[model samples]
Target chain A: MPDRSHTRPPRAADLGAFAPIALAALVLALVPLWAGDSRSMMTVVTTGLTFASYAVAFNLIFGATGQLFLCVGALAGIGGFGSVIISDRLGLPFLVTMPMAALLSGLFGAALSWVAVRRSLDTIFTGIVTLAFALSFQSFVLGRPELTGGENGLQVAGGADTLLRQPVEPYYVFLGLLVVFLVVYRVIQRSHVGWAFRALRDDDAAASLAGIDVARYRILAGWIGSMMLGLTGALFAHYRGFVGDTTYAFGSVDVRVLVMLAFGGIGTLLGPVLGAAVFTVMDELLVDQAQVRELIYGVITVILFLSFRQGAVPALTNAVRRLVGADQPPPREASSADTGIG
Target chain B: MVAVLIDGLVLGLQFGMLGVGLTLVYGLGGVVNLAHGQMAVVAAMVAARLMDRGTATALAVAAGILSVVALGVVIDRTLMQPVYRERSEHRVLLGLLLMLGVGFIIDGVLEWRYPIEALSLRITGGPVEVFGVAIRRGSIVASAVIGVVGLALILFFRYTTFGRATRSVIEDEEGARLCGINPGAVRTVIFGLSGGLAGIVAMTQAMTSPVVSTAGVGLTIFALIVAVVGGLGSTSGAFLAGIILGLVNTLSAFYIGTFVSSIILLLAAASTILLRPEGLLRRA
Candidate 1:
């Protein structure tokens, strides 16, 4: 039992990073109640919350650990499809199916990390490899009509109908999940596993030399990340009451996640939350300007990558902290672990 | 089946060009240009429009190639340099995402400007028979052009001092720098040359098949698979792997189904990445 705190001391201001996230969560929790059962607005907020969960899941692997898992949609689709089938056949509730589906998704994520890590390939290679998996998943779902219902997908029986009948219910349910995820994220950030992930992300050789099981931690991060993603996907499946092959299309869901995360921030927990919320609102507001919106999103993605690699949340946090400059913690080297050879 | 083989060969040549171009940049610059396919698409679109509007095919293609070459130089000097200087250990992460962003922007712009339709240039040529096989005469021409270009590349790499210097940088950047080779200059040239190669790809696609603006990601994915399977930074390996993948693609499409070909390609690439990251060709 090595002292994890000695690896990297958790800063007091690390807790300060939570202020914005907490405020954001407060707003998210109130959105459905504020909307007073307006379907369209509820839809938009829930959708944003759904994507925000994904962004959180993504941040675990891609943002925190520097492992690239580009197949979140596919993995989540796997979770969604599994949950729907299980619920239909066994007549189980979400409490039972969601975890089961998450387990399956987690295993898949583990497989993705193993496939890439075993070869000791870079993140770019990992992304390419996972992208292949993503494509194959889509092809599989589409190719098998009997199993997956093909492009039409499987309906969740009365799930979406129930949500529609009670829009505020889903709003609370998903927002609760979002809050749980934020807590989990914070726990990971401050825990021993968090320290290990940070260490592994910073320098694999150095981390491995420090008596840490690099493979173990990397795989652990993958499982955790994908499990979160899987839960979100399962919830989304129930929300839409449909899980089609196109639900995980490369051109649609995958790209959307990338854009959302890149725009908000890659590594920061709050960044993804902010990104998902901002981008979703932007998309909703500019729904009619599809082409222009896509073009703008594309441009912003590039611009953010070039100029603001740390993303919106971190930059703002730093600025706020600098202005206040009260009780400043020791400066930690911004971990450059996520960037690697393509 | 014979037509499949002929078509496969032609496709293989194009795949070879993509692999070579991508790996050249990868080996020398350590930057995988995910936007490589978009550059090709842009050129093809330009050429297709020129031909559509009643311009000479040759002149249109020449103009297209020249335009992409310039675009290549401009991209390297302006866009990519900052990505290169992004000043992080996560250059690959940031770099790939940066290029992907650029790719999407280019795609969006093209789709908006164009009719969002797949446009393929139609060349007027008669069918040709060779070795008791009938094939598209255009396919033969494209294959021959690729063959000559590939050969010229091989010869240039073997005989030219500049090529040797570039090769040196690919082999060992620091060593080449010590040996007085300007790695930066070599990389810039490779970037420009890769763009030229992308222009060739666009032209080939126009002659052989339709290319849409959104097709950049797909094309880049295929090229990435081929390059990875061939060996990330190995040229000859890419050539051989390209042919193998092309032939497999044709057979799969013929026998199983159209979508199955991509599955096989993706599977092959994933397995290669997992089981043999160095690639199966055994570059010696």
Candidate 2:
């Protein structure tokens, strides 16, 4: 890989672009406070934030990198199971087991990316492989009664109260982690590596010719994405106070994760978080009519995809640009120079 | 031991029937059609309904197949055709969402109409004793049918002009279009054929076991694994993979246990993607 580090100074404006992020954070923090009985509201907020992390991890590849991985839930499942096995079965502490689970999940993600990155497999093939992985993961978990506790699932020792010691604690923990991940995401998006990722997304051969290590970037994206998923899985397991193989099974919470990601918009940084929040509210409102909930969600997602192909975030950004009466920025010219490893 | 092998082979044939249909669609259309398994459920339910209305077994099967073909055509024309035209990255995602919605609609309608009560149908003959092993007559008929259909499909794809056109489009769309082939027409035919095959598989499997809405998703996932493990775009690959998977499933269930058997199969499928990403059978 060519070293392009000395070509230009790092983009300083991007680092200072945090006004919107701060506003968003403040809004989230005040949600429970305004809702009153802040406990339940905090619980809901924590859950949404945790899921948003998974979506963000997914967006690393799906959005910025342009690799669609349908097995996000399966990776999360791996993390959840790993944490449960280590913390509950092997008697390891939650903190220790959580990182271990995240590491293993990243390894699995890398393994998956290795199969997918080079082949130029179409979207359908990617879906097939990822879906198969998800199914296999579920089957393996459910089939192994000894290891996974079968359909009954493994029960962790502590509930949310035990870990957080109070509802507000979990809320703060999730919010802090969410902010940190967002920062990491934005930083990566503005970095040379991030540009390489975007380049590969647009055209792999061109990116490769430009000296970007496409395969390595894809693998790295998967690894990073899986690590985020693992973190969320661990947090979920701890919060729920139990882990079940069926938790990530098809048509269960896994589908909900996909819906949230899609609803918020693929490839956008803030879409997943917004999507999660929207879905949670919708789920709460439609709790009674659960049967038709997925149908409605699916329909809405289809409509959104049709109307806003680039996703809600981009669409909103474009609208803001138009409203401000600013000329649309010209597309960036492709750099002919070689860069460091993607 | 002989009985287990015989039973596994028969079950494997039934799975192959379903797997081949899925393989064909994926090969030609590049759509996974997550609703494929649910199509089987729809077929089985239709057959059961026909039987309840005092229809003959043959007639029930025919009705099931016909209904599935109609449903397939409708799906291809409306939901799938638009996605094909757009040719967007979201096609697969949208297809998945649409199918999930369809699955829900079908499940809801079926549950409301027929309920989940089990219906056991005996296809008239007693178990045949062959080489001191007893095999159900229904299993024998199902296996023979599957074998015949599989052979016919191979022959059609190999020799027929329509088959050549389909293969041409699958191999190189631009090249085929230059040669005056309509990819859309080929897609429609393939989808219809797949639906009919799914119907047959569903009918046979349901006859052997029982049909219910809850079983739809499980069977779809099972068929998907079989298709992927065998090879995504190869019919022969799917057939062979299904048999291999069936044997592994049976042997594992018998020796290790059902749970371990499932795990082993899952691990085997996953490891294949990691090791041989192209799958067991490579389509030339």
Candidate 3:
């Protein structure tokens, strides 16, 4: 019932947050300049951008609202499969199918949030339930081989004639998506919705006492975040011209996204992008030694969770602050957003 | 129908054992061992490797379980230190993520070294009749072992002084500490016991179906679902939930298809959270 809108000028911290997104966009905009001709390089970067987008979406749901939707891969899979079926089977336009798929995913996410809220489940319980959803989604995909193409996956023919088929064009498309997602994240961070998110994340019972509609805001975050995941997933599927269960499996996608978000900074605007870029490069470097790469990734994940819980960006900023003799306790905005039960 | 029920009960007993391991850790340390299944796989792999080297089956299995117990203690002493320092939600999240990493590491290493290795414990016997239906002798033996272990756990927790100390810590760590109970030691012991339980379940599972290197994640998922449905920290609840889920699983697999059974099991777990977030039987 409160007027959760703010028409006042943005604060200095809020404006400062946009700087990283702009810099990221500018730097990424020029990626196509050098890697334009090399198809493999473009493909890799484009794939990295896709994950970057997924990480950003995850950040919105988790870092903002403390809803640990472990089914990142599942929601994206929904979008990927939905768009593929609608566009390929029904012969609909990519534009129509993409939004429909995204909306469907958003609704599913909202429903998950509704269930979580209605039950008053904690973070881990929410994670468990979503994880169950993720496992079932994988089974469903594999169980219905006739429609989903089973383990072999389906060849996406819907966008074969479009710019999506072009290597460089698809790279830009994913990059564009990543930039837009970052902007959306920044916008949310500066809004009254952001205020409500912070309150509930800090103390849910207190936030509800202060007249914030905890359930509504959590669902809103889940819906919007899932829509982003769905949109990016569908776009990635069409661009790659394939969709499969493994494409969004728990081990393949969810693990990497969680690792990336942790390495980058949970709540920071640039964290997901930074984390994605680093891991993308690491992924490429160890592409040949898959097992070894996974082992290394596992070690890195453990180390990050233990020592670098605040993530690389925050750590770097803190170090820089200390160097500049501005050793005021790290800014509250950059502190850990871990919604722990006090 | 009777054969399926017996098979379901067999599998359910193992599921109950797995849930007990997970629930104990969650109750005592507020840690969710996402690597629970990996521990089982590692133990199975150890046993398989030993058997290949001509070790006695019983000795190999013992060594395997001990190895896992040591692994659990090491993890509790080292990695879980920071995790335990965290309180409530943070502790759960950190523990889950770190254990997930551990699972990945185990999976990566085992797959790299033993891609073709699988543990299949062959019991020399004929089919046994139960309730007018023939059931595999191996299944009956596995179920018997699990039943004994489950009973031992119940009695251990019910009557033992150390078990009472453990319950005290889980109920109120501060109060237990004030009463001179070392919560840290209790947690480490439970973690090791949980690891041992996981190893035992893996061996029993191999009596029914091969426990391969890649079975880690799936095993973990089953354990998680059982623990969640039964209630996070209740031993008896785990067994009850496991039996129920096991029956549901076998029925769905029989009526529908094997592929859809997993989906059905997951749905059951999700609905449990929706309908009964506190789980079937609260804490121990």
Best by lDDT: 3
lDDT of 3 at B248: 88
lDDT of 2 by residue, B190-259 (tens): 8888999988887777656676755667777778888887777778888988888888888888888876
Model 3 residue runs over 4 Å out of place are A1-16, A309-342
Sorted on TM-score, highest at the top, how do the candidates line up? 3, 1, 2
Worst 10 residues of 1 chain B by lDDT: B83-92
**Cα lDDT tens digits for candidate 2, A120-155:** 565555666677677778778887778988889887
Question: What overall lDDT, based on C-alpha atoms, would model 3 receive against the true structure?
Answer: 0.85
Question: What stretches of model 2 exceed 4 Å from their correct place?
Answer: A1-12, A34-42, A89-92, A115-127, A158-165, A305-342, B53-56, B88-97, B108-119, B274-276, B279-284
Residues B205-251, candidate 3, lDDT per residue (tens digit)? 98988999899988898899999999888889899888889888998
| DockQ of each two-chain model | 0.53, 0.30, 0.58
Top candidate (DockQ): 3
Ranking by DockQ: 3, 1, 2
Q: Stretches of candidate 1 above 4 Å error?
A: A1-8, A11-21, A33-37, A89-91, A158-165, A309-342, B87-89, B116-118, B282-284
Please give the lDDT score at residue B27 for candidate 3.
93
Candidate 3 structure quality by residue, lDDT tens digits, A1-342: 011122235655656656667667777788779778899999998999999999999999998889999999999999999999999999999878999999999999999999998888898899999999998889989999998888999999888889999878888888888988988987887778988987888789999999999999999999999999999889988999999879999988898998878766676666677678777877887899976876877876786677634433445334333332432222222322211101
Q: CA shift at A88, candidate 2, in angstroms?
A: 3.9
